[model samples]
Target chain A: MGREIKLALVYRDMWQSSGKYLPRVDQLVRVAEPIVEMGCFARVETNGGGFEQINLLFGENPNVSVRKWTQAFNDAGIQTQMLERGLNALRMSPVPADVRKMMFKLKKIQGTDISRSFDGLNNPVNLANSFKFAKEGGMIAQGALSITYSPVRSIIMSIWRINILN
Target chain B: MAGIGRPVSIGKMVKGIRERHPDIIIQYHGHSTPGFSVASSLEAARNGADIIDVGMEPLSWGTGHADLLTIHEMLRDAGFSVPDINTKAYMHVRSLTQEFVDDFLGYYINPKNRYMNSLLIGPGLPGGMMGSLMADLENNVKSVNKWLVKRDKEPITQEQLLLQLFDEVKHAWPKLGYPPLVTPFSQYVKNVSLMNAIQLIKGKERWSMIDENTWGMILGRSGQLPGELGEEIMNLAKAQEREFFTGTPQDLYPNQLDEFRQKMKDKGWDVGQDEEELFEYAMHPQQYEDYKSGKAKERFLEDLEKRKAAQQGLTSVAMPQTSNSESNVMPQSMTIDVNGEKFKVQVAYGDAVEEAKAEASKEEPKPTSSGELEEITAPLEGKFYLTKDSSEIGIKVGDKISEGDTIAYIESMKVINAVAADKSGEVVEIVARHGDDIEEDDVILLLK
Candidate 1:
């Protein structure tokens, strides 16, 4: 068949990461066809992270936007995914289990096909709920470990140094 | 990881994950901020990453992720079965993005964020937080410089302020237990660092302006940190009587969906075709309220129009007016305030302008203080100090001083403002102590 899909263009986050606002739903609709025609991204990230918050800030109902926009991508035979904060679940603080489950259920109904969940601390416990709930809502559960770099430290050397200091 | 990792590290991590769980698919989400995106993407893919996240042009690189075209092409070149990106559609999307930027979003974007910063390697803040970080830097620099200008001090540059803030972030990250520099945690680290930098710049000590949210992170309410809290922070927490948290962070926030549902019903808000609206409301209560009340829209529209007007003003040139009179020229000096910052502009015309400029440059001899007792008063209400530290006392009783000499300093909101003498005189009486709280027009000394 055609080349296997291995890329998910995070369109919403691009707008947020580059500037301060997301594209309006109409703008998203206009670009969705072209993005699908490109045949590059297997999935497109329509919303996640700051999506709902930003939509609220713009005085738009994010649910409406998500439904309309993700529908466009799903109709085109492309999978639609959202970024989910593990434990936080689209928020800065820990979200309740029932509310978090409802988020996945509602998002799946709103045409979202996948939930790429990540925990800031890379804590597995925080992400366990997301895996369970996303699958329960008939969405593909993708777990991501937040990555960062640190100079490799020798723990044994450190312990020896600590003992010497003590 | 908030910051990007080296390609080798990413490859190792991906390979380890792939080996441990062959059925699991790995996706590496890395930012292009540190200029290591292309290499890392390739490494991740080679090491068994099933998907790689990327962004489109006009929104790629800088604080955003690497572009899809580059990653696709690179992966294919490296012999991966990646799908071909339709060049025509890519161009169309690119053009559409540019159009969006030109329409209004360009005014909000900081141009500095368009390029990669190697310095981001130190702080490792993810691309998501970089937008606000740059914006905060711009606002804080303007504020600090304005305060400095009022005290007749030289203005600090954005680079200088950013560098100090970066250093502070590096310092604060480990001190606060090396929480992964991501959302909520990253923001907390950044806010604390920013506050510390501003305070340090104002001659105040670090951790002097830690807010409650930062305290939350420090107290371990968010979660377990990767490292121990610094002794200084622990001591401060002890002094504040804030207890440490060792329980599950998520359990602290119990199930509150029913509460939110009841509240939404009271407000007559729809729960959407699904319950997505309720979820949004529950997640962000204040923002949702503002959105429903139309306050957010009003504020956003006002800000957009203000930015648009400013752009138009900057672009429109002043056309010279044609006059019938030939000698329509004169020497003038005036002060103009731009966005609340004052600037003095001098305009001079005629052949003798050079000579006049030279003549004006010469300083006129000043009459010494009207030969009377002069009181050196605090220019603002703040803590007054006679010296920067104990090692040096700037002025004592019976010390001679000239006009414009910094007789004392007044610190307000952590910013130290030098109080200068209005006229030349000998210090006759010292009235304020080194650490006394003083007010505007409060005399620090009597000079004669």
Candidate 2:
């Protein structure tokens, strides 16, 4: 048999693409249940990437939302995932190392199986802490390579080195 | 991810990295800000990028990242091995996501943001700022419309204003040393540019509408800009100087975990081992406090509806009157006609004693020619401040001031507007006190 390729669906984009603000928990649950039952995907990118901000902004409990989604996905026999912005973790800016670690731990306990980590600047130094926390929390750690174009040859070379090291 | 639009450079860099680090796994994350992220992602993939980040269709273009459907099709067409994705199941997911989108659009849709724009490439607005920019633009347009109506002038189209604002942002970026357009920094740049554009259109002086946050960013408090700011910008920063940090911005933030925990505990929050709740409180102190106290959700929903109605040019009501004297005092009644639709708004004031006391505390009464004293009123509703520097006591009683001299500042809509003296006179009584919230047409001071 040919090599079977695994597909991880980023369902967060589905809501984001709609160019709308945060979707209500009930709305998310209704949409997520059917997709979770599909069973064809390797994992579903179901949380993080501003969902926490959305929850806070709309006065919703993020913990409850995460737990509900995780339980729903777990029941459907599918793993859940999140995109962790390196130092940012879940906040607007970088948090303390302890805070970031706590975030990973909480997500894992709440049922996030995979954590895709990426730095905005493509700096390996930034991604290191996230990778450590994700692994320590027993979640799949997927490192992301941030691509950008610059006319400066040295900057481009440094980016290449960072990518290689990651 | 940052800088995801330079396809050729990223491609070359990726190829070079792949040649030496053959064992390394590479995943591409690109943002579609400059309308080149998809091509850049493909370029990286062809150069041995093992994974490429993409969003689902409908959320996948314009300031969003690359589209997964487009990528999947392209990769398959190029004879590359791909996943056996359940198409039928994916469609179902799309529909479900669409329902969420529909609900969101009902409240927050900005018609201007519904299409892609070529102008964004020059200003390089981050994907994250699209919604905020649209919202700000809409609000600015409404303000401009009201101002124009008051002056018996024709209001400019929102599109024209947006284009002009874009041009201003592009102009301001270089002035601020072209800092990477991302969160916090992006918001700062957009705000500064928006204010600059609005001020220019309103025939106000430059930096007249610069806010505290933007001032902080320029002074290197938020973080270092990519390069040195212009001499003009720096001079302005000097005038409104505050203690600025040279190190990482986040280091300046005091640890608040213990303080938050104590407060939450006092509120009877049984947060034992629930790190998530703690994190919530830590991330957004005020919002989380309101939420836990059961006062945020309802207000948020009500505000959302009001905002949506305002966007639709329909009748929108303001927040209910409260007895808190600290709150900004709004007008008791006002009549506004929009497109021939008149709105009669009735505002209820709080306790008269508290209101009078708050006003009196800010300004001390001084005797003058009772009929000769000219009362200078506030031009807008905002937080009033006596001086940018706290150490220096601002204009006091009997101080001589010249016309056009800025005696105070009012912060409104995130912009700090300078309150200038309309006529030269000795200060008789300062009515609007420092840090006191004031309304439009409120007596700021009396001079003779």
Off by over 4 Å in 1: A1-5, A151-166, B1-3, B318-448
Model 2 / residue B193 / CA error / Å? 1.2
RMSD of 1: 13.2
State chain A's TM-score for model 2: 0.86
Tell me the tens digit of each residue's lDDT in model 1 across B68-91.
878877887788898777899999
Predicted structure with the largest TM-score when compared to the true one: 1
Tally clashing residue pairs in candidate 1: 3
- Give me the TM-scores for chain A across all models, comma-separated: 0.86, 0.86
Model 2 achieves a DockQ score of 0.29
Q: lDDT by residue for model 2 over B1-448, one digit each (tens)?
A: 5433567767777787778778866666665645776677667777887666666655666555666678777767756666655678778767766665555444665543444565676667765457556655654565565555445555666677878878987778778755556544566677777767777877886556565556656766545554567777878767756565577544545565666677768878856455678877766554476577665677667867886665565334443454433335545676766677978865433222232333434544444337888877776665688875323468899999998788888865434667788888989889888766566556789898
Question: Positional deviation of B407 in candidate 2, in angstroms?
Answer: 14
Model 1 chain B, TM? 0.70
